[model samples]
Target: MSKHNVYKMSVASVYPLLVAKAEKKGRTKSEVDEIIRWLTGYSQEELEAQLKKQTDYENFFAEAPKLNPSRALIKGVICGVRVEDIEEPIMREIRYLDKLIDELAKGKAMDKILRK
Candidate 1:
């Protein structure tokens, strides 16, 4: 008793890529279709909203949280955070920093900088 569904996604440009992944994973086209169907049980608008929230939270905390300009630095604030907690190792390269700054400089978004 297999409970699966066949559905379509309007991923026009990347449709070929999705098919290629399915093939690479040795899954039938219908199997891929079923997985997509299960995922799409969530409304597109809801998924997009969740994605936006995730993106916003990730961007907001990309840098280490700092003490407010006028506020005192408590022992808890400094001691509670680990080096890895504040700095994401994946984004530690100079190339990444330059690219991030350049993207923000385009005026599309503002990524705050953390000064030690």
Candidate 2:
């Protein structure tokens, strides 16, 4: 599938999966929210608004108030692709979020998950 198609995917569709991954590991929804906010700089209200709107990943990211600079430091393999090797900016951002969620699901410390 094309990157465009992936970008156009509804974040709402994936949100539950992320929540489930964390919950199954004894993490909370609020922790998932915190990871997202750390990555995208979205406040609780803004994040909830996006969730309620069922925003596509593209717009959810594009309209971000601020994407944290530390996101660039997130390095991992997601979907069999090394995030640092992704050439497209948008795809990299998407993978960065994926990686953060993966770390959260694995029970990494919140401080480490935030790349602090």
Candidate 3:
């Protein structure tokens, strides 16, 4: 009588900790593979392909909006808010950012802003 194999599986990107523990216990990759095959039933190649295709950065950057500064800056001396009047530095930082953005909109070189 001949024995027939019914299922096949592959293991890729095994976690280092789990692999270490399994190795110490003398567990074969095929044992893990058989368990995974029974649980998820997904071919290892398919799982690997899906994992490789995952890209958080690509998705995040693709969905993010581009910022334009020309419409967002204010150049003239801003009043109503003074050093003593404003408690937080955040407002002051925003004013400075506005000035820089305005300068950039005017096509001024960054070096010019640094000099000012």
Candidate 4:
């Protein structure tokens, strides 16, 4: 899928897959949630609200309470592209989340995964 299609995809649709990705690797859903909250600055309640609203990723990041400035520290390739090298603002945020999820699934510790 093109980048635009990914941006338009609802978080609800994508969330389950994220959880499943972590779960398959023996990680818990809560870990995934933690990564998300850390990256997006979304409270647990607000994250659930967005999922229920079926918010697309573009709006999800767009409406995030605070996109953690530390997220810029996240680096690495996701889907064969280095996230830090992405020029588009929204796409960079999306890949930041993706990179975090990938790290979680790979058994990186919570503190390190959150860049804490």
Candidate 5:
């Protein structure tokens, strides 16, 4: 799929799947929320608003209060693509979230997942 198509996907559509991925491994939705907040700098209210608004991935990220400086530190393969090798900036952000969710599903410690 084209990067533009992925960018247009609704965050609401993906959020539940991310929660489920973590939940299956005994992780809480709040932890998923925390990871997202840590990466995007969204407040609890802003996050909730985005969830309710069903924002698109592009806008969800574009409007982020802050994209953590440390997100550049998230490096790994996700969906057969190295996170650090992604050429598109927005797509890289999406993969960063994907990688974090994958780590959360795999039971990676929160501090490390948050790049602390």
Candidate 6:
């Protein structure tokens, strides 16, 4: 799908897939939640509210209470593209989450995966 189409897709629809990816590799959904919270600065309740609202990705990141500055430390490739090299801000945020989930699935420690 094109970037525009991806931006319009509901985060709720995509959330399960992220969770499933980690779960398939013996990770828990809680780890996925922690990753998201670390990246977006969303409290668990706010994250759940966004999911229930079926917010699209563009708005999900846009409306985040505080997009973590530490996210810039999340340097790596996701989908063959180095996330730190992405120019479009929203796309970078998306890829950051993807990379985190990828790390979780790869059995990377939570402290390192979170860039803590």
Give the top-scoring candidate (lDDT). Answer: 5
Residues 40-110, candidate 4: write the lDDT tens digits: 88999999999999999999999999999899889999999999999998889989988999999998998
Model 5 bad stretches (over 4 Å)? 1-3
Q: Best to worst by lDDT, what's the order?
A: 5, 6, 4, 2, 3, 1
What TM-score does candidate 6 get on C-alpha atoms?
0.95
Tell me the TM-score of each prediction against the true structure.
Answer: 0.26, 0.94, 0.29, 0.95, 0.96, 0.95
lDDT value, residue 101 of candidate 3: 39
Task: Judge candidate 5 against the unseen true structure and give its global Cα lDDT, from 0 to 1.
Answer: 0.95
Count backbone clashes in candidate 2: 0
7-107, model 6: which lDDT tens digit per residue? 88888999999999999999999999999998998999999999999999999999999998988999888899999999998999999999999999999
Off by over 4 Å in 2: 1-3
Cα lDDT of candidate 6 equals: 0.93
Q: Name the regions of candidate 1 deviating beyond 4 angstroms.
A: 1-10, 42-116
Model 5 is weakest, by summed lDDT over 10 consecutive residues, at 1-10
Model 2 quality (TM-score): 0.94
Span of 10 residues, lowest total lDDT, candidate 3: 3-12
C-alpha RMSD for every candidate: 20.0, 1.5, 26.5, 1.9, 1.5, 1.8
Clashing residue pairs in candidate 4 are: none
lDDT of 1 by residue, 29-102 (tens): 44433332222332444434434454322232232233133111111222244323334332222123223233
TM-score of 3: 0.29
What lDDT score goes with residue 61 in model 5?
Answer: 94
Clashes per model (N, Cα, C within 3 A): 0, 0, 0, 0, 0, 0
lDDT of 3 by residue, 12-86 (tens): 222233345444555544444333332233366643453365423222123223322231232354444432344
